[model samples]
Target: MDTLSKLFKNNIRQYGMIIALVVIMLLFEILTGGLLLKPINITNLILQNSYILVLAIGMVLIIITGHIDLSVGSIAAFVGAAAAIMMVDWGWPTWAAVVASLVVGGLIGAWQGFWVAYVRIPAFIVTLAGMLLFRGLTMIVLEGQSISPFPSGFQKISSGFIPDFGSFGTNMVAVVAGIILSVVYIINELRDRRAQLKYNFKVISQGMFLLKLILLVAVINVFTFMLASYSGIPNILILLFVLIVIYSFVMNKTVMGRHIYALGGNEKAAGLSGVKTKKVTFWVFVNMGVLAAISGLIFAARLNAATPRAGTNFELDAIAACFIGGASASGGIGTVFGAIIGGLVMGVLNNGMSLIGLGIDWQQGIKGLVLLLAVAFDIYNKNKRSV
Candidate 1:
């Protein structure tokens, strides 16, 4: 019992946020009269939130390193416009255009990183400047008009669904994928538990572990079942999954990841300990640029156009998702998983409210309140711990 209690305390942030997500989902599900989780709606939710999820992944890393990027939205917009021009106007191949766009994203990150990391400009100021600069560039690139009718291949990046094989009246591919994921999750958890035990680290009781496993398995299966019922998985959903897995591994099992946390915890100390704060900071922003670029492409593809006003206020949503997912306002704390949950929370709220006929204005206000509350909760938790 004591060990279980300790485990719970140690993981309060993760567990709490997850519980809050479940509660919010349930609330919205009920309010929407069961429409929130319908197969079609579930598919739409994943598609709609895919880009935000991508941004949240990168933003969580930025926050983890005790920095923030205010220009991701603008960068995304600019990259989208650039891609549109390359593919639609310049007659570039779809594959080449995407590759070029990602490279541009990286270059843009390097540019901002040079200012923030080596030049000693505050990230806030540099990114603020970047926000304005990129937005203007996007406007100029688009000539204050929208570019449309991207190549069919580019359009498929966002809207394509996986091919379904014959199954028991569902997408057999989705069902099989779900089962595999559930098994993988259980194995990972067990492996983690064994490692904790080997190191004499505290772990939850076996009963609690089993309970968690069951719940996770159930959730994954149900979600996959829904998707199977509809369009089987989306290509974008697969992309998001790959990213989550890769980033989660990078953050949890890599030396660079540890260094990032150390940097955020205490920069001076990290520097004293020989951590290359500047390089790390620079690379972090560069990576942010790459993710933002991917987001831009996805968004543009989904809309089948690039507009001058594309990506307005996207930075806010990404930041909010990171915070709501349990990233510390002061940095040195957060997780990739947390960011996904946070994005989903926002996604669910947006979808549910829209279904119920709530106006966009009300949705914005409510989202603001939720963001405020999440930050407050985090601060309160920190203060309580210090006390």
Candidate 2:
């Protein structure tokens, strides 16, 4: 009984976002007459939530460090506007626009990092000022207008998909690739388990591990088959997949990642213990700025345009996703997977409500209530356990 209770607690801590995802899906699935899980909707959900998921991952790290970034949306708008101005207005190459946007994002981050890390201003104050500053900059750059008709290659950033394997009706290439991926996944899982055992960490039972593997394989195969049936998969989905792998690796395997975790857990202690707190914090915001820029560029690409209101309220969506994903408000706890799950939750809600023809006002009200409940639950759970 004690072991079971411990297992439950552990699962809650580790997989609360997953549980919430399932609950939300069920609620919407029932409400929307099973529209939520349609394969098309599923694919759309991934695409629609991709940017927020990206931002949430970075935001999770930021919040884990007991800081918040309010300027991401504005930064995104500015970056998108810059990308558009460079590509369309100035006739720069798409690649040039992309590189410049990312660089500018990093510089903007560094600018804010200067204040937060060296000047010792609170992150909230610095980013709040940044929010206002960047928004004004965006408007100035665009001069109260929108830019459009970007190059085709640039437009493909968000709208392009990989080649369809289903066109061949049982394309051997996709099947072979799927098999290879499954084998690689199994090997990696085994190696991870062995490493955990070697380090004397608590390892799950082989049965449970295999069960998880089987479920994971099932989901992957189903998804692969569906994509192969449609247009193989989206290029942006592939980008997101690569990012997940890279960020997951950084968080789990790298010394830098360890420093991030430590800093988040306790800044003063981490600083005293030689974690280079200022540099890490600076880099954290820098990374966030880069991602926000990337997000902005993608959003602009999707619309084939940039507007003054581009990315309006996007920071709220990203931060809400992070909090909903189970990152502690006080800091020091979160995961990439959790952020993705949370982003999907919001995306699904938005999509499902739209499918049911909920007006914008009602949708916002509903989402606001849900957000409130989620945060309230998190706080209540924290206090309850403290007692």
Candidate 3:
């Protein structure tokens, strides 16, 4: 019975996100008069929260190490300004401008990381300083004006979707390929379960495991059908999927990823055990910088312009999503999947509130209440465990 109780606790810690997502979906569905789960809104939810989810993944890693980055929104703003200047003022090619923007963002991250990791500055102080510094630079670059009319190809980075293979009469070949891919994915998952059991790792019950697998498969097929029914899927969505897969693998399978988690869990212990905390911290910021640059580019593309205020309050959204999704404020406790779920919850809340004709003030008020409740619940859960 104790073991069962432990299992339940573990599942809640690990899968609280999935539960929250279902509850939010149900609530929104009812609130929207059943409009919340319309296929289009579901797809819009994914696309709209894409940037927040991306930032939260990196932010959670930073927080795991007991650090917070208050400067990402500013960094994103700076990137937007720089990208605008590159294409408009400097007349750089679209690809060159994109690469340059990312590099500049990385340098900015490296600058901040150096101070925090090597100079031994507290992260909060260093990032606070960066927030002010970068915001100032952004205003200088933009000179209080917005930039627009980027090259056509550049604009496509955010706004373009993949062409429908079904446009040529429902390309049957793609359907067959998808089925084969689905089968392979299922087999791989089953093999992973077998491997875990063979190693005597704690595993979910067979019934629970099967249920999860089926649900995942169902979700995938439903998404595929939606795209197949429309103008195929989005290229940006495909790229996002690739990135998530790669990052997930890095976090779950690679040595560097292990070290990051270790450092987050206990910095002194990680350092004593030969993990290079300095290099890890530096690169974590670098990764965050790159993701921020990409997000800025996407935002610019979506708006068809780069505004001076493009990223205002974005960091708050990302941080809130991370915390709401189960990342502890004290750090060393979060997951990529959880962060994604959290972003979705926020996205759903925003969409549903807007649909219900709630004013911005009311929406913000409700969101603040939700954030307070989520964090309070987190603290209570931790205390209960300690007791």
CA lDDT, every model vs. true structure: 0.93, 0.84, 0.80
Best by TM-score: 1
Q: What ordering of candidates by lDDT runs from best to worst?
A: 1, 2, 3
Tell me the deviation in Å of residue 80 in model 1: 0.6
Measured with C-alpha atoms, the lDDT of residue 91 in candidate 3 is 96
Tell me how far the alpha carbon of residue 26 in candidate 3 is from the true structure, in angstroms, after superposition. Answer: 2.0
- Residue range 1-387, candidate 1, lDDT tens digits: 898787677768777888988898888889888998899999999999999999999999999988889999999999999999999999999999999999999999999999989999989999999999999999998999999899998999999988887657789889999999999999989998899999999777788889989998999999999999998999999999999999999999998998899989999999999999999999999999999999999999999999999889889999999999999989899999999999999998899899999999999999999999999988888898899
Show model 3 residue runs off by greater than 4 Å.
1-6, 168-181
lDDT string for model 3 (1-387, tens) is 454467778757447667877888888889889887776776676667777777777787887777889888888888988999999888999989999999988898888889888998988999889889988888888888889888888877766666544446553433554566578789999999899999998777788778877887777676566555444555567667777778778888999889988888888999999999999998888888888888778778777788878778778888888888888888678777777777777888999898788999999998898788889988999998899
Residue 230 of model 3 has an lDDT of: 45
lDDT, model 1, position 166 = 65
Model 3 residue 106 CA deviation (Å) reads: 0.6
User: What's model 2's TM-score?
Assistant: 0.93
Question: What ranking of all candidate models by TM-score puts the best one first?
Answer: 1, 2, 3
Which segments of model 1 are wrong by more than 4 Å?
Answer: none
What TM value does model 1 have? Answer: 0.98
Candidates' TM-scores?
0.98, 0.93, 0.93
